[model samples]
Target: MLDASSNRINGSIPLKMGEQGNLNYLNLSNNVMSGIIPNDITLLPNLRLLDLSSNSFHGAVPVTKYSFSPLEIIDLSRNYLNGGIPVEICFIVTLTTLDLSNNSIGGQIPYCLDNLIKLTSLNLAYNNLNGQIPLSLVSLLEMNLLNNSLVAQVPDKYRYCFPAKAFVGNKKLCGNIKGLRHCDLPFFSIIMPLVPMSICIGASLFLYSKRFDQIEGPGIQLLCAFLPR
Candidate 1:
């Protein structure tokens, strides 16, 4: 186990760090490291608790064909990491706590994340992620998804477990969740379709009135002159 967290460790992770297969429980959180997370780190055979959060690491989360079967906890939050949450990470059946909050990560949260049946805590707040909250994630004991760009209705299953604060900052998101407006039609949206029809009706009425006056003008005047005074 190697713990070097909360340091001023700068620059990219060393590519050769994966060569040490025997090592486990690597924690380098709260550092000043910047650059792409080396892919080789995922190759570690005995790695269990990997924490690289609160750094400046950029680019996609690493994926590997070979499974990290023994791995459990993974925290890469509060970084500059962008791109989708890699599907490969979901294959680790042993994961319990996963945090990727406060990053610039975009794309939909992989539905495969539901396969992590062991996941109890998940934090994905303050990202660029968009999409509905997966119904499968409702089993988690703790979750936070605040300040994302996610849209669509919040699934009914999740409303009881997670509060409205977990889903705040997403302007497009609406549902039965408290503190969010209902997803029903707005006044402007409801009236938009009627606008063109109303204009057409008004135009037709004006034209009909003008046509009637033109056709009846001389006849009405001549009839009035001929009628008993």
Candidate 2:
């Protein structure tokens, strides 16, 4: 258990520290560290809480190649990390709070993140993420996704659970949500259903008119032939 957070630690993380397999809690956040996060740090067997946020760390997140099974809280926000979030982070079933906000991360949010049943707080605000917000994230107690490149309709399940601020700064997002515009029905979806019904009605009308003409034609011809002669 080591807590060296909030200090102006100005250097790269020592590579040898990753050999500490028995470390339980490590917090080196709020410092000025730079360089790629060492992959060995993920090898810590008993690590529960890992916070390296508010730093100058760059490159991809450290957990892309390894699994952090025992981790519960992960705060890597306010860094310069880029690239799509690795799907392996979702493999941590014990994760509760995940913060990757205020970075340059891109790509669509992975649907596999919904597997974190214990997740309660999620923050992906101020990034370059795109695509539709996954419906599975509605179960979270707290979420912040403001200022991103997300588009399309907000899932119906999330309309009432999350406030508009959580979804603000996205220009293209729309739904039945309170703060956003209503989602427009696609042109084909609106027109397709009416087409079949219109064809049926038109066929019924044409057959009815033909039957009426057949019934009246004989009577009119007989009346004219008998009276005019």
Candidate 3:
């Protein structure tokens, strides 16, 4: 297997490497690379391993039909990549290990993750992703989703595997997770108190005005009768 991980390589990956279809394992992780990843790397036919994690790559990851197939391990974590994970990446049937933690990517986790029956380890921690944790990952041996803006109830199975600390620092997230706080229902504060108080004030003012009019009405009449008219 081609293991170039932790090599401290810098600069963008050259597009010329795409022609090497025979290469099965590619690892450039723990490097200083920056700029957009060259899309041409997807052309490798026999590529089974890809590691470009722990770098400075930015922008969307290029996805083609070949991006997912024949790949058992892929890591893009600890980088500056943004944008949602492409839908094609989740449907890759052969993907066994995937790490995409520590990024700025947002949007809900794609529903296609259920199709990845072979996925054993998945890491999507430290991002801006929101929405519920998909139940498909219940069978995963290991899954990390820490530090996201997720806002739905997590499945009991997943909560059992991953504690609340795995999902901390997300103020908007909720559920029975250990470290998370409960999300208050919308309008619970204002609608419950302010509305009732306003109605009570209005009713009290109406009744007082009616009583005052009744009391004043007879007095004025009596005074008018007593006056020389």
Candidate 4:
């Protein structure tokens, strides 16, 4: 039972938090915490609810061997945390709710997220994450991935689950999402008109090139052959 919520606990979570093997509820939310969550926090074998949301922590979420197994609810939302979300958190395999919204986190959604076999809710909205939505997330009951930089088409497999608004603010994004603009490209823009003109000029020159060649060539040969004769 560790409650450091809504305080001025700036800087990283102290490494010693790991030694508390009996800690079940750890809430450090609504604080000024910064830096990576200590690698040692995972030592809390009994931790169930780890809430570190609404803070200023940066770097990847650290998960040790012990800390990741028993986690049920984790809220790390509304922070400045950046980098790819840890696959180890997905390894918990029993997460009911995981919130990571409103951050600067970037990179493609992890491929192993399907490992969250029991995840019910996942929030990753309003980040700088780019790349395609992972196909593995089809198992999720509800997911929020809006307002990111996700580009590319959402596969048809996930169309029934997520809507077009789930992928907003991504300029390069495309797919079957409704109301999203289809990527339009002018065919003539890439087809250079001058190339055909050049080909025609080349062909005309090739057919009539012998006339110019006759005028330019053999003058020295003619002079030498005639003079010697």
Candidate 5:
């Protein structure tokens, strides 16, 4: 348990800092530190809360291949981190609050992130994410996905859960929320109404042809009657 918030700690985190075998909570927020975030993970097995926000840390977020670190609340917001959000974050099922907002992160949100059944608060706003929101985020109690390049209809789970501002700045987003763009009807649905009319027209043509066929035999009989018989 180390609390070093609101200080002038400007250097990058040391690689030897993992020597603290029992360190659980690390708070290094509001500092002048600037560098690529350390990827020497899997050494801190007990780290649960990691807060490195309000710093100049730049580069991709570290993702371990195999992890036993019980991280739950991760606040790496307000940084200069880039790269796609890793699906490996979903592997940490114990996570609850994940705030990666206000970063330069790009790519689609991992669809498998819905697997995080314990997640409650998520903030990925002001990023470069683009794609449809997952259909279900059952455990989320709060989420903010504003100002991204995301497209498609807003899922029902998120349509009313967050306000329109949470979906603003996105170019192609549509939802039921007031002032949000409405979703366009599917092409199949739009053409479905004309199906019955087509069937009726086909049936009418067939009956007319059948009636003509039936009346044709009598024309020759009338021609024979008019001649000497």
Candidate 6:
């Protein structure tokens, strides 16, 4: 275990950091570090918890297939990183908590969240991530998805378990939440009203023709005009 957080550590993480094969825990949060997060650090096989939050790290996270890391808790929040979350992150099946909040990462949340069967907590708030929340993620116990461009209906099962705050900043999101409006169905709204109105009008014309069936010349002409040619 190594705790070097709250220090003045600057520049990129040394590539040799991966050489520490047996180190299990590392915390470099609340530092003055800047640069792309070293991919080498992810090569650590036995590391369990990594906290590099509250730094100046930028660019995309270097998560890749080569990362044989068995990390269970990964925190890279409160940084300046950008780009879509790498799909390879799902390969880290041992992950239990993932915090990528307060960055500028864009693109949809990954759809393969079921691959992370052990993930219980997720925080992707305050980013530029867009698209529907993956159905696989609804199974999580704790999550914070505030302030993104996500679009999806919150399932009834998760409404009370996860509150309005989890989905507040997203305008396109809707369900039975406190802050979000109900999902609008423009298809039904515009089409349903026309259906009943047309039926009523047709019924009225048929009844009027029946009333004047016995009347002669002028009445017959008027009723014909009301009917289709």
Worst 10 residues of 4 by lDDT: 204-213
Query: Would you list the clashing residue pairs of candidate 5?
Result: none
Q: Whole-model Cα lDDT per candidate?
A: 0.78, 0.80, 0.73, 0.72, 0.76, 0.82
Per-residue alpha-carbon lDDT of model 3 for 72-155, expressed as tens digits? 887888889899988878656888998889988899888888888899998899998988778788888888888888775565
- Top candidate on TM-score is 6
- Candidate 3, superposed: residue stretches over 4 Å from native: 66-68, 183-229
* TM-score-best of 1 and 3: 1
**Winner by lDDT:** 6
- Tens-place lDDT per residue, model 2, 57-137, is 998877854776488998989999999888988888899999999989999998999989999999999999998898889
Task: Please give the lDDT score for candidate 5.
Answer: 0.76
Q: Write the per-residue lDDT of candidate 6 for residues 1-229, one digit (tens) a residue.
A: 8999998888877778879989899999999998888887778989999999999999998788788799899999999999999998998999999999999999999998789999999999999999888877878999999999987677776676786799999987888898987875433233333343335333332122222233233322333344443
Ranking by lDDT: 6, 2, 1, 5, 3, 4
TM-score for all predictions? Answer: 0.78, 0.80, 0.75, 0.72, 0.80, 0.82
**Runs off by more than 4 Å, candidate 4:** 7-12, 64-67, 183-229
Judged by lDDT relative to the true structure, which candidate is superior, 1 or 4? 1
Tens digit of per-residue lDDT, candidate 1, span 45-147: 8888889998899998765767664778888888998888888988888889989998998898889988888999999999999987788888899999899
RMSD of each: 13.9, 13.6, 14.4, 14.4, 14.1, 11.6
Better of 1 and 6 by TM-score: 6
For model 1, what is the alpha-carbon lDDT of residue 94? 87
Residues 1-229, model 5: lDDT tens digits: 9989899799898887777879999999999998887765433889898899999999997766565578888899999999989888878888899999999999988888888888899899999998777766535788888889988777766755776677787878876766567676643334334444324322322111221223222222323333332
- Candidate 3 has a TM-score of 0.75
lDDT of 4 by residue, 1-229 (tens): 9897887777877778878888989999998888787766755678888899988887776664455547888888988878777666667866789888998888888887777787888889998888777888888888888888887666777778877677667766666667565653333223323234323322322111221222332223322322312
